[model samples]
Target: MWRCALPPLHRYPTVDELAARAAALAVRSSGDVRLRRVGVSRAGTPLWLLSVGRGARQALVVAGPHANEPVGGATVLRLAERVLADPRLTAGADATWNLLLCLDPDGLRRNEGWLNGPYTLGRYFRHFFRPGFLEQPEWLPDGADGAALPETRALLRLQDELKPFFQCSLHGVDVGGAFVELTRDLPGLCRRVAHAAARLGIPLELGPYDTLYWPRLGPAVYRIPPPCPRDLAAAITEAAVESTWYHPQRHGTVTAVVEAPMWGVTAVADGSPPADRDGALRTVSHALRRDARVLERVLARVRPHLDGVPDAARLLAPVDDYLLVCPGLADAWDPDTADPLRPLPPLSTAHLTALRIAGGRIAVRTAGLLHQLVTRAGRDPAGALPELDALIDGWCAGYRDDCGARWIPVARQAEYQARVVLAAFHLAGARSGESDWGSQPVVPMHRE
Candidate 1:
């Protein structure tokens, strides 16, 4: 494995800080780096496209596609600095690097409150702001031409312009373990990334969670599943099609999404079969159902008060989506209907439980957003604030007591993310027979 030294990071940087760093790097590169304003966000924030190096093949790295996930922004900045410092990293990959930093500046600004953090669950949820699927640039339906967000259009324009051979979208979870999703199952990629994460004291997620239905290539690595017929139909009609799906179909781009965790827990790392499979499944299912109900009750009460409030629909869209889809997810976990031939790993319980808590956090966050909207509109929050606030506090305390979650340092998370991306970049080059991948060192930023 190639080792790179990344500068230790104490906290996550804000969107403006990341933008400034990118600009500074471009200025310091003496014409080796170029920065351009690609497009403007929904709220008119400038979308930046930072280009570095030159090669036969092109690679695109996108950070902060999701507002709640900011680790990627740091990864992109650090990786850009490292590449500029050591041109051989991209030179050996035989690829020019194009990095898009902070795709959702509007949503990211709402999340800045806890970015440079105490890294606690409570603070994160309190300041969290994840837009609904309809608002997320990365998952807009493929045919929604007139409806596409400006950020989405910018990314689409980049893909068409660069026609990148390799893409890495940096993403992370608030808790659980680290995993990677690939558009193509490149041999040994998973092993290398999982090993690197393990070396960094990061747990490899072997559980059924976000990529539950995806095809697993190895521990913690999954191939992005193709859109099902139903999903394709929905996309043609109204639903969103994820970027992971859109990239490969349009450009045959070998995309890798690296997911790290802010809080690491061992439960997601354990691969042993669950002792009480049915019990674990039922427990998680019950939690999801309860969370959905709680959110529903709160939303029903606040819906009338939010009828004409500005930004109310956008803020409550996630809650509405959750209430609509969460019940089906709960029902799908029916232990009685589970495939007996294929059992879940022990991590399933912990991973599913973490997801449950995440659901609760979303509910609380939605209620809080609603409360703000109602208050601003000169209407009462209908006594929902106290209940939601109590839930947040209770879940935070319960999570601490149950999981013994460890705060994965910001630097460590970035380092692991950098390793995965660099390794994948190397693999992409090797597969293309463009360069001597064996001789290329995986470079990372060192502390000044």
Candidate 2:
């Protein structure tokens, strides 16, 4: 009985490190661990599909589906080992597990610089590499000779071929506690999944309800939310739901994505009673307007400087347009209904600071990318990069000053995420069986 100790969770596993871990599992399992080369990345990195456990129902787990959210890969690797350490964990269950670890390796490679080091707020924000919305794997264009990366093509083929009955991809956000997005509304599944997460000490995200058009499944669970991918993507991106949603040519299947916070901000789940409800709602509305204005002002400030940058009109919109997008999509629920999501948590002073740090970092990175693009395209004949660090630095310094930040261990984030999903997968595995064998095997995994 061997349990792999989780590394520091604040940092993520490198692509090579995770790949080697997968190969090592195969060796330890005496050839039972089957490694499939789903496809090769653009940079020649092998995209691996690790197949372990045996059962009737097919389950596919995509980790690191979004390159910027790297912790999913670590969580998947941990879950994979969990499944392997005890064969009976899946014995007599319905699921045969398959995982695509780091589906976008090129993007993963690009983000390697920030994975291991300086896991500081500024370091993460400045170093993070988020592809333009269209280039993201979740919404990659599938047309002939489209700008799709090599890895996207491989995933399309694998998904179409496997036609999995259950599919999900792992994702996490830079701030906030855990939340889930479901393709369908199953209250029973929600209770089970949410409770599982709670036992792990992971709080449900009860922040501002920004998902206005989607069905609120549970406390933090939103179902088939809209402001759909195409809503924002159409203007600046070629992203569409047809490409984004899991359609294995079947019905009665469920797909889920869980976003875990990189750090613990206890304020995310504050459902405390309030004295003045109307005033609270007014404050919330005021905050939304303020955020929108701030974004607009920033965009205005940067507009003139963007002239030398290419695609300035199309791509740069999201840089500040995200403000408009978010406000337009704010939680517009009537106060009469059980509007629990609205009153759950006030953005703490510290949380707001962290959120600003994320926003500011993203803004700086956006400008930095534009600077790189303009120079690389020879739009800037002098090869000069746009100046942004000083502006970003100034804001970060202010953020640090009245700062109330907490650095939750990377292990806790990964464990809370892994345990909940493991419980859900175990539940799915049990759904295919007649009797419940879940209660017994988990102890060994925990204490052995």
Candidate 3:
């Protein structure tokens, strides 16, 4: 019996390197891997497309859409290989494939070296210190033009052209477990994936209250206490929740996106069972096979709705507000480790005030201050701040029961120390809405 080998999938690659790799695979597999330029990176580097297999239909899978969360890039590369080698996977009766792998080259290049480094225990932990997007090779808009980023443009173009039957964007969070967020209901698919995890000895926490394995997009994936439905995308889009993704076409198709947690995969791959590099690879291989089965089952059951699903973006506002409020504060209830990497801290008074002010201006209603804090923090994290290094380290140490630090269960820890710093930033932003931080000038501090 051949066991799968775990390859170092965390390593990030530059646009050129990724393109070359895709190109190489395409060459090796001949028609199995077709290389073409989808778009250029923000920095003007070419982003390549790799398509394998044959079918009348197409499925577009994108990885590394964000600059920071990049586990999907590796997953895509592996999936590409599998599709090329396994004729059964692509040539079956309903087979079709058009994989769009690694959209944000600029983001990946910034930390590519660290991403590709050794996969020892120490190396894994060391990755937390790698710099964020300020060092990224990608160009980010100045909040004026979101998705103005070139990579996003290419992605939108692909969506316009392929109008795929299935669409998934691969993203990973520091904490949280694996979960799939469908554009629409894929009940059997979720069950298949969940069962696959269980079979692999990976923990499976489904249904509401499974914060570690929740999705914000579809209904019924995350159940807040008392059975409240928490749809991340729907919550964000209160103004309209009826039609989203691509306008529902009468003769249209369904798009399925998988929001897999990097840590969840890693924990399953390298947890107490001690899955080394090779073991992790095998786990991934098995997991993908299960994913295929789930997708096939779901497709067989649900007819695609031609009308586009509702674009529920308004619901995300409160969640985004809560995330901006603190670091690691939101992770107090996760059943996972104390600190996997990025944890949401509590919201500061400044952030609360900002939310209040913004809400009042927009006539939006929200829960009481404390409840808002807990609920918003509970949602998946949107982003993080820089000063969280020490707190994260301490939490990680606590997970291992280090002698120097007191450990708290992830769901139990109080707000993070970074909350104070975030509050300060909010205060700074609020005080001088127009002035830069340096110009507004807060007092400097010296360490004792």
Candidate 4:
């Protein structure tokens, strides 16, 4: 096990703080570390990229692709610091590290209200901000109708320049066990990464909601599925594209998405087949439908007041997408309508169901942002705010009672994520047949 203590973070750092730290690290490093301005965000915040180590191969680590998921930002800083302190980490992988500190600074700044601390579910939702699907930099499709955001373009430019052998996008869950999504199935890699997280006392997410359809490599480790025809058609209709889908084909980069959780519950680790699979599926489907209805009602009430509200379209984008597609999502979970030839869907566990229910937080976040927009526009939300607040409150309470969700400390979360990254880095190096590290096993690193 590659053992090292991750620096304890009392709270999530702000965008400025992250930038300053990256600058400081580069300045203090001995020529091996370099920092550069990659691109400017839509809001004019300069996107910074830190290049650390001088191995033969190239690897890219991107953090904070989604504004609400800040854990990755912390992971990036920690990884950069660790590799700088012990170059052997990257040397073993035979790779130079290209770390993008934060991909969505504008969206991250909107989420700063809850970044500092009190990592409670309620507070996170209160200050949460996630851009709409098309608004996300990473998921932007190539040759889409509209121009790619500056952040996406910056990543694309880096991809062209480096054609990295390995790319890891750090992502996090608000409430669930830890999991990972890999672009390729490198033998023993998933198990090694999962064991690293498990050693840190982080429960493995057996069936994460987002990767439910993806093929499982091991416990909590899934293979990122290709963009389905349905998804591609939707992207075409929306004039959007997913970069992850095309990046592998274009660059032959083995992409790995490491997902840690701000909060975790034991139920998510349960992999026992549900005794009543159809009933469990129906229950989850019904809950999703119910949440969608609540969001639809709130959107309908607030739609009239949205005129002239700055960013109203962006704020409502997710809500609209959720409302429009939620019914289909719910139906997909319905066994009656499920494809006969498709493998059995992930069995619903209490934590998996709760994670699905917590999807309502997106609606809650939308309502909160809409309230601000409406208030700024000098118009009332017509009771939408209270309804959404009630919805969030109910979800939080359920998270506590039903799912047993507990806040995972910021440092521990970062440690688990860093371990996964290191393991993947070594594994990717070995898989590339460019290094001898594969001959050495990834010994399990336990928390001391």
Give the TM-score ranking, best first: 4, 1, 2, 3
Off by over 4 Å in 3: 1-17, 118-147, 205-251, 264-323, 327-389, 399-448
User: Compared with the true structure, what per-residue lDDT tens digits does model 1 show for residues 150-196?
Assistant: 88888877888888878989888876788888878878798888778
Off by over 4 Å in 4: 1-8, 91-93, 142-147, 231-241, 337-355, 358-363, 371-381, 438-448
Q: TM-scores, in order shown?
A: 0.89, 0.74, 0.50, 0.90
Of models 2 and 3, which has the larger lDDT?
2
Work out how many backbone clashes candidate 3 has.
42
Better of 1 and 2 by TM-score: 1
Give all candidates' CA lDDT scores: 0.73, 0.59, 0.38, 0.75
Off by over 4 Å in 2: 2-10, 140-147, 186-201, 208-212, 225-230, 233-240, 249-251, 272-387, 390-405, 430-441, 444-448
Scored by lDDT, the top model is 4
The regions of model 1 sitting more than 4 angstroms off are 1-9, 144-147, 229-245, 248-250, 307-310, 336-381, 441-448
Q: How would you order the candidates by lDDT, starting with the best?
A: 4, 1, 2, 3
Candidate 4 RMSD to the correct structure: 3.5
* Predicted structure with the largest TM-score when compared to the true one: 4
lDDT of 2 at 310: 50
The residue pairs found clashing in candidate 1 are none
For all candidates, what are the clash counts? 0, 3, 42, 2
lDDT, residue 117, candidate 1: 81
